[model samples]
Target: MSTVAANAPGAAGGGLEDVAASEASLRRFLHGLPGVDAVGLEARAATLGTRSIKTTAKAYAIDLAISMIDLTTLEGADTHGKVRALCTKGRNPDPTDPSAPRVAAICVYPDMVATAKAALAGTDIQVASVATAFPAGRVALPVKLADTADAVAAGADEIDMVIDRGAFLSGRYLDVFNEIVAVKQACRRADGTAAHLKVIFETGELQTYDNVRRASWLGMLAGADFIKTSTGKVAVNATPPVTLLMLEAVRDFRQQTGVQIGVKPAGGIKTTKDAMKYLVMVNETLGDDWLSPHWFRFGASSLLNDLLMQRQKLTTGRYSGPDYVTVD
Candidate 1:
């Protein structure tokens, strides 16, 4: 856990007093965030993406990326059987190597939290669920909170909630902010310990770098332990540049607030090369503090297979094929 109190709305030196004060105050704080220069941001991400990592460093990063994956299966056709298999995959990504590290968590829809919890019990892996009308935050606040509470009650370690982009883009910034606060509260378990809250911005719908930046701040101020890039249901999800911008948000948020929030870029990232680029971006932008699974995550399902293949190639002198890795 971070030093910043998750429930402390206005802790001294937390840099959240003004943001939590009022809707008007929040608007000012968000608007005051520096505007993003699109071209420059893209250039920086591209430059970092071009970094060449080989041999030992590449092997370490492959394992690190595997550990950072939140192996997900969020389909409407999801079943307990499929979730159980996915849980197995998350626990033992490479049967060929017992030394292979397990994934950080198994991400599924709210209803599958119990199934995943049962399947992944007695392991270090966590169970994360998507709530708040996931992919589309178009539901009543009560319903959303109930969805979140259900997941927590079912033993979810993390709750990924979607913000009302309709409310946010329509200038109802306080509504969006308060909704996040409410959902964060809903993540609390009966034991008083709460599931980590990851607020999804759905940046593709937000449409501008400036809006992404503002939404990042909005989520952090609203007490999200992590601010995710997308729900992965959007037309465009986790681009390198967007992920770069979010990394910047977390970095700046920590610098100002002393709160160490995490960043997860979901949806489109695939391939060991793609994961490496993101690692490079984090290594350069946020330094090593954000390098762990505690502070960064790659929300991917197929990306894990590629990472496993890369790991196998590193272990053996020969390249491995998809048939070698388990299919889940």
Candidate 2:
């Protein structure tokens, strides 16, 4: 709902060229390093677990984007049925009938935007669609903008646009920056309300802490309301370390410009414990200001069930069935 003016005052100017050079240098350093192993994952996970897990009235918001309900492996009718079922019942997966936190939005590809719109018609939940050749973002600029426009016109409340990382990594920072601004411009809603734009950095592809920071700043300066990680389409996706860096970027940006931006760490997050770690990071690193669903979201499909299961465990002292907690 925040309007990020294209010509916002603090827009990255001379510093962008310097940042781009730093990003390239950092990328090369990361590329030369060896791949991480299970030990590293365990160490990081353990370190995060040591942090607090108490739920506040202000819990971190989650965006469960049902990217694909088995694309080629499932029938369209079945997929639609499953999505509808999830929206109708999967939101609150409690057998005891206690209320649960509703997901922030339901994200799907543009083709399913209308279906999602229809399914979530009366609920406060929003409908988000991935446009501009999501997961790759290798399309023409005009076509990408048109894709974003069409999705917004089709009742999408949020638009998740992927950055042209290829261009960015190739040293064309301005091109990538302008592309995001253009797509953001095209996402104005029918009643003149504009859809929130979440720029996916695809951090896995970017591959470094410094480059991630630069990309985060670039996306925010180019009018992104939220800076998201990954599309869940690549071999590597959002991880804790990458998210930690991005959160720092958002925090720094807010301090400098007084503009609060949101962060959505998507992909590879599959458990209540994993979700808790992210929440802990947001709390510790970015402070409580970014704890709300508006400032933070988990772009996940299976995370809700895990959170419910854990909450039930905390209350009833036993893990409930998948049916006991709704899944769609």
The TM-score leader among the candidates is 1
Collision count for each candidate, in order: 0, 1
Q: Alpha carbon lDDT of residue 221, candidate 1?
A: 78
| Cα lDDT of model 2 by residue, 1-328, tens digit | 2223223322544333333244454345334333435465446646875775454421322222211111110123447666576566534445474455566777777777787779877666777788997768787998898889888888887888999988878867767777887887788766766888889999989866657877887887777888899888788888888887778778877776667788888888887667767777787788878766667777776676666666666666788765775544
Candidate 2: list runs displaced more than 4 Å: 1-49, 54-78
TM-score of each: 0.96, 0.80
Angstrom error of the Cα, residue 133, model 1: value is 0.9
- Whole-model Cα lDDT per candidate? 0.87, 0.68
Candidate 1, residues 1-328, lDDT tens digits: the string is 1212353333324556766577788788788888899999999999998999999999999999999999999998999999999999999898888999999999999889999999988898989999998989788999999999999999889999999999999878989888988888888877788888898999999999999999988888778888899999989999999999999988887887788888999998889999999999999999999898988998998999988888888888777865888775
In model 1, the runs with Cα more than 4 Å from the true position are: 1-15
Give the TM-score (vs. native) of candidate 2: 0.80
